[model samples]
Target: MDIDVFAATHAQEWKRLDELVRRRRSLAGEEVDELVDLYQRVSTHLSVVRSAGQDPNLVARLSALVARARSAVTGAHSSSWSEVSGFFTRTFPGTLYRLRWWWIGASAGTLLVAFLAGAWVVLDPEVLNAMQTPEAMRQYVEHDFANYYAENPGTSFSAQVWTNNAWVAAQAIVFGVFLALPTIAVLAMNGAGIGSSAGMMIVHGRGEEFFSLILPHGFLELTAVFVAGGVGLKLGWTIIEPGDRPRLRALGEEARAAMAVALGLVVVLFVSGLVEGLVTGNMVRGRIATPVGLGIGFFVEVLFLAYVYTVGKRAYRKGETGDIRNTPEAVPVAG
Candidate 1:
């Protein structure tokens, strides 16, 4: 209980702990183990000294030593740059590749719905009328549709488009927890909107114009949406049939993966927004040629798909699951 005796007895161990902490980066395996052992012993000494109402100076010294030792033992976290790099190279693409089928199916289904809706709207004058009056529809096809892109400054317009599309994609992924109905509805509504617009334009003999504007941005934007919808549905399906894992555990895994997809889509949608605002809008304003704009959009879309298949497939093959690394497993409970 004597403060002086306690300090003297543990002085060597404390000094060793300090030395180890100072040289943590260069520590040998045995020295690392010794540092950990000293850390534990010194921690106990500090606790005992405090219990005995010991010397304030000794207490302060031990406190500092223990803090440094703790840091040394735990080591520093991965750098922010490392984390960002890992997410893009491993986590994001791996998730995309792993869930490729789900999103691909989503893309196919949504496109099919859009095509059918467009055809129906073209064939059924009543359907077209139900959507809008003839005058309003004509105005939309000739002016409103084309003008929407060039109405705002390119930077501000890109920001707005990015925000809106990102929110929609986030909704599609986050709402997957509700058994995917919301995700399905989002996809359906999006497809229907596109189809209606296309149908209206085509019927007015402006199909080329519609595509000229839409294709420059729509390819990537729609793909990002399809990815979100697919991931969302997968999350919901986990609730329905979790396979070999516990239902809650499966849901947790999928939910985390869904979050990664959401974050990745932010970057994806930003690029799409840039295309819409800069390339598509410029095309309308006669700032860029139609073929050049279309080529730029197509190149971006192809590059993205190629990145997903190559980087994503490689990462997935290496056992990357797109979930956060080293997440603590849930405690096992006996049924």
Candidate 2:
């Protein structure tokens, strides 16, 4: 096909399509129909021009014209406050509810590991000694551990904690592609760290103090971590078992859902960070009573659980999969 001849033949339609798109907002009913018709014809012209491998300039012009015309025909999407509200009320909770089993198991398994690790440390003097010198252990149990929360200013500390925890959560979700080994490692390391700390405190008779400080934030913070780990494992498992969908397609779907969890966790971790830096820190500093702090943290944790079960369950029931709404179906590929 002669590029010049093709351009001359379709030049009029392209010009008309451009005009229609520019005046799309004020188009009359007949003009709208005409715009749609020209949009299709120009799209075909673009395909033909590209396939012919002639006149790159002409191809570029047609591509841009087609894009504008298509947008005019289909309309454009814009973000709104409703989208933000829907994310929290429906998407986040629904995702949490849908993946409830995965995260719950993660929580149970992590807690068990923590328990076993603490028990081991308490039961074995040699193991405990190997972990730290007796003096250092005493220092940590008596002062260092408690001082951690109050050492930094509350606002900065909260920001620091939020960033650190968010990074951990992101790692768990992103690294899940490696068969979840990294996610498991992350969870195990977290559990062992908590358990060892608890063991050290319990051995020194500060177990009550430990719980008072840790539980005030650990309840929610740890849950967020568990959610990330569970979602990561689910992602890894998707690679192993994609169900009825093609492996790549299934992975794509789950990966998108994992991203939603990742984003939701940022907010979750932020709240936990505030509790840790403000409530727990104040309790350590004697500004707030230990019992009140504990109650506040517990309440927050309970609130999150309630949100998941209520909003999340409702959204899931309504067919919310936590994935982006209206995701285009994957095109079939030949093997």
Candidate 3:
């Protein structure tokens, strides 16, 4: 390639990159730092080319510089777009590949924690029955169910729901920063509660009724908790595996991503709550039309998780390249 032609092409790209760096949030300070560093090098090459007055070696060097600059610009643009998309879509897992081992490990660890905790409760029928005392179940079904809606008639509306969701989301997000201890605690408490309740019901020979009452909303509710716990686990591992970077820096980066996930989970919990409150109320399967409704809800959750798995991985890679620093207490594991 002609050095002059190559330089001209890349000069346009360099200028465009400058414009993009200013406009795009993903290409923040650090990315711009790299671009400026390359720009300085390019400028020096340009100066050499000018002084050399068309020497073949100078032209060749200039061409090499142009290629490098062009490649950098291309990489920057691709990375920035990837980060931007991931941010909008809330895709973190794939973006932080360096931290992948941590994410997966923490997630799996949290779930195991939950399962183990639940196992203890399940093994102890007495503990299971204690939490779900007849009076407690009655109160939950009658007063608590009605009182919750009385406390928030506006929850059915979008804005109010989002506002309430944002508040809980913030709690989950901020609380996510501490990571391991908090998440482990949440998983244990919730998991144990479920397991004990199940064991108790089975012991009391109310197992069939319990399954029927729980199967509809419990599935969604439990899944939400597991997802939230997974976010917390990811955040915890950020503390453990902050990479070669400073621990604080790695924590900040992973925290942002975890916060986004936790926020999303809060929204999911609201939907699950609504279903439990409204649909679960008519415990009579026939009245609530359990089969079709539960089927749809189950399908939606499955599809949603699948989408998260695919899109999140792709977006995470993009975010890491673009550098976007983006949690949860669980009440239960997903059924």
lDDT of 2 by residue, 240-277 (tens): 99787656656766887899989999999999999999
Q: Decide which is better by TM-score, 1 or 2.
A: 2
C-alpha lDDT of candidate 1 relative to the true structure: 0.87
* Ordered list by lDDT, greatest first: 1, 2, 3
| Local distance difference test values of all predictions, in order | 0.87, 0.86, 0.53
Q: Candidate 2 vs. truth: CA RMSD?
A: 7.6
**Candidate 1, 222-282: lDDT as tens digits:** 9999999999999999889989765765676688789899999999999999999999999
Candidate 3's C-alpha runs over 4 A off are 1-173, 282-286, 317-335
Q: Model 3 compared with the native: what TM-score?
A: 0.54
By lDDT, the best candidate is 1
Candidate 3 lDDT tens digits, 1-335: 24567567566655654554454446777766777666555555554443333443443444445544555555643467785565546443343333445435544654565456556656765655566677886665445633443344333533453455445434433555675666666656665655555555555456665565666556656665555555566667667776775565456546655655554566566766665555555434244665755775676567556655666666655544223321111122221
**RMSD to native for every prediction?**
10.8, 7.6, 14.1
